[model samples]
Target: MYLSSVSRPASADPPTPGRPGRRFALVSGNVVALGTVSLITDVSAEMVAAVLPLYLVLGLQLSPVAFGVLDGVHAGATALLRVVGGFVADRFRRRKLVAGVGYALSAVAKLGLLLAGRSVPVIGAVIAVDRLGKGVRTAPRDALITLSTPPESLGRAFGVHRAMDSFGAFLGPLAALAVLLAVGQSYDAVFVTSFCIAALAVVILVLFVRERPEGGPPDTPDGPKVSVREALGLLRDRPARRLVLAAALLGLATIGDGFVYLLLQRREDLGLRWFPLLAVGTSLAYLVLAAPLGVLADRVGRLPVVIGGYLALGATYLLLSGPVHGWPVLALTLALYGGFYAATDGVLIALAGPVLPARVRTTGIALVQSGQAMAYLVSSVLFGLAWQLWGPENAVRAAAVAVAVVLLGTVPLLASPSRLVTRKVPR
Candidate 1:
């Protein structure tokens, strides 16, 4: 089978409230139910990771570049896994099983962290392996999400999924803050708790979640076999080809979300770690706005959401690199930051899904995510280098500038998402 332009199959775990048949019947609809499971899991993870850099720097005595190096390895591993996992999902028809395995592995990694000694390399290796499973699981799980949600309601379905994911994101940091406050910012305790939460997420997947539009056996599904030539040919298709190109451009331009946290870290250096209370503020904002934004994009246009969102994000970063810091400033920045995530993430995923040939949906999603992973490697490395040379705040300013340039350059693409979006599928 060939690697065609990748498609996003619907995987970002969020609580999808039952969409009334106003659009299409919800498939597993339990996709939203599973969002809760993910939320619980993330709460466990965020607490540790939110302050993980501090652990590395304060506890491990690493440098900013080391932080970047770790980030690159994590993203790089996850990114490459997406390419391989997509093919497996498409080939074996075992999307759900793979997803289950991925979650189990991630949970195990978290558990391993609890047992490991003060060996930084060992812990880092475990995190990388755990992320390897994430790479394996994400495409198939997303494919399942897309497969489960009917075509017409794709935007809402993904929106719900992202919201759930974001909610988990919110809880993770908040939980971390609580742990730090209670136990004096102990990374080990954070790791132990996160392991338990991850365990719960895996349990829910095994017990409750089922793959939708269920395909073939784990060995192989009965679809047009994808040859490498066929995969390559997906790029030659008109809009599918164009959509993938646009995806690559965005991927190249958009910097790592980790940078945003780094920006928060800088604020901490500026005497504002207490300012991450603003992260909570941002999560709340995402909670309020994400679904509505999803519904809005469905009614208006995906381009408006994406292009406008990018512009807003650029402005948010610019403002962040401005005189912003402390409680008031951090709150404002994170509010827009979370909004930036809410506005763009689901819309981009929704836009990509409809444009590609259905047969290569798994790979199409993989391609976009892979492109993102590659970009993370580039941007994160650049950001890290800049941070080490110039310091965190200035490097962030550079990233914001780069984003503005990309946002402006990509404006032309948003003008005609209709051209890229495929004709409506049969009801």
Candidate 2:
């Protein structure tokens, strides 16, 4: 088995009684480097995400159902590849290299958008390619964080990392808006610029991020080899199985960001130019709350934090369909939406990190993520169908109800006593 020590800075102070030592000790240099990479990469990814709904729905004149299919594809196109990437990273012990390849692929896909030139199928293909990169990178990248951080600090470490990532998400829409205004609403310019930024992120990953921290277990030929059977066997582990099931349930309750923003736009009659800013509001809230909520997860419990996040999601959907009008609804919905992401995104992974063994940690993370992605694909399509059959208002209200039902169902799965224990993989 591959064993590793948590990477802490030499300057880190030991925890003292009555001191805020946990706060200071939670993040390490390796985590910061990873966060920086995510920060830049999200800026590139979100720029496209911010504008794509409008481009597809209004610019391309696609129906809600078509957009939903495309959106679902965008989210889940490479779900299986998440497992492949994780297995590759674990088997080769080349996490950074795998993640870098994923980033580079996403960067190149931005240029693919330029070549697609308004063909719906071609655009869908490009979006799938872009999401493939994300699916490929996410597990290995998250595993790197889990490997480097102490089990106790996983929540805070992921929190800090996500906050930085959310900062990039926060800036991306503004950047897109600026480019669109400067270039006279030319999406090609936005695509070109996004490509450049994503390329820069790949460079940073290659230069700054380490495959594993120093003084940890070296990647050696003699280490126990990971196997496909072992990866599949993760489901036999009760905690891992529950986590994956819970993740899928949560994912099934979520409609994609595009639908939420588009609904907000239609309800408010917002101008086309203001649409990108809707993402900014959510990202801003996520950026501010991610770290704090992460720390809260560590102090309280991961399950509660995750449950709270789902509650926020439920509230956000209700606000969308509620009778309340004007800026208050928008602001509240965005804030709740952001809180939903902040509380759940990294925290759920952190919840899993401790329970998984070191030997196939990446594979375990990939399973959880893949389950969610696959379920999200279904949710998006169903939501689109609902929007078409029943109006947006009725569809959103149904979604809120679904969220509540899922939350009630998931609580028992995640709250089981066997779910949170840290596993000690034999060496």
Candidate 3:
């Protein structure tokens, strides 16, 4: 259905011959606003994301294969939107406006989950809307983050932004866990809470965040210099190429946490409530590590940070595949999983911005994100099918093997930013 639409301010039509960069809130303001929304949204999302597999499997009796099919379809649904998001962001040049719409779409996704009936496919469709919002917003959002910051400190800016963004991730699941404790463990409570948070994110973004006037530097050598084809063509650089390739491979091998939770549930050994709590452990670890890891990336290099994240995540997949049983194993694995997300997700976005123009920055992020989501789409389906065909450990093992292979292949190509990507200045 339709969300309450927001009208965006006019595109930066050459900034009217010298409208000063008005010492606005873009850098700090945008980050803070985005963080607030993220925190609220995460409170909603983590509630759902944390226990979605349980909803699919035990609550609905869907097989691992069916879950995979659903996950794949959900991820792929988002894939349809990135090109549109990028093209729209570039064409209308209304990055902030497009972003507002994205947040609303994500918020609505949670509502869909609550309405979903007993049918497995309906649930998948609900998840699909949720993820499509992710696809749409991601590019435009990153593009705005880039627009908000000073050129030299893009890494630091994005990192701090990431750290703040992840704070919500930490709280969201805890809120859900609280819901489970207080309101009783039903899907409706989590879904409605998540939807509320998503709506709150929209309100915060709309009111507090502002756009830089048009003809903004790097976005324009004079004015939006690059064509869509040229923007897409920039990925031809070796580092961009490697990063996307590595991202795609990682995506192919990687399984979402939802699938992992299902595996835990499928074993029939753990308490029903344990999964969300374990998810809390994961989100908390991610929140704790996000800032520190982001700082480490700024100090050492994004490549090292990113590579380490991949290795750690690959190992986590291996661990989940192994005989480590009970809450202890689950707890540690969840923590590492969060750490993996904390380390890589933002840093990669940081890495991406400098490599692309302000105009096309979102598109670049969209492209890689789209790739990863595509991998998720493919991996979930394949992984679920394998789990059904063989078993959970075997399915996980197969994913781990793919991860290990890609990691070894990409490590040699890693390089520092000065060499890897070209830096741009707002003209």
Task: Kindly list the per-residue Cα lDDT of model 2 for residues 213-236, writing each as its tens digit.
Answer: 742223343677888887788889
Can you give the TM-score per candidate against the true fold?
A: 0.84, 0.92, 0.85
lDDT, candidates in the order shown: 0.66, 0.85, 0.69
The 10-residue segment with the lowest total lDDT in model 1: 1-10
| Candidate 3: segments with Cα more than 4 A from true spot | 1-27, 213-218, 221-226, 235-239, 265-268, 412-427
Per residue, candidate 3 scores C-alpha lDDT tens digits across 1-427 of 0001111112221222353554232345666676666667677777787777777777888878787888787676577588678768876777778888878888998888777867666787777778778778778877777666543344555666666666776677677778878888777888888888789788988888766633233355356444768666747755556656666766776777788666656553777777776677677777788767766665556767777788788878788788667767777777778888887887777766655545666677787777778878888888888888988888788887887787777655444333354323222
List the candidate 2 regions with Cα displacement exceeding 4 Å.
1-23, 215-222, 422-427
- In model 3, the clashing pairs are 12-214, 43-172, 44-194, 217-426, 217-427
Every model: Cα RMSD to truth: 5.7, 5.5, 7.1
**By TM-score, who's the top model here?**
2
Ranking by lDDT: 2, 3, 1
Which candidate number would show the highest lDDT if scored against the true structure? 2
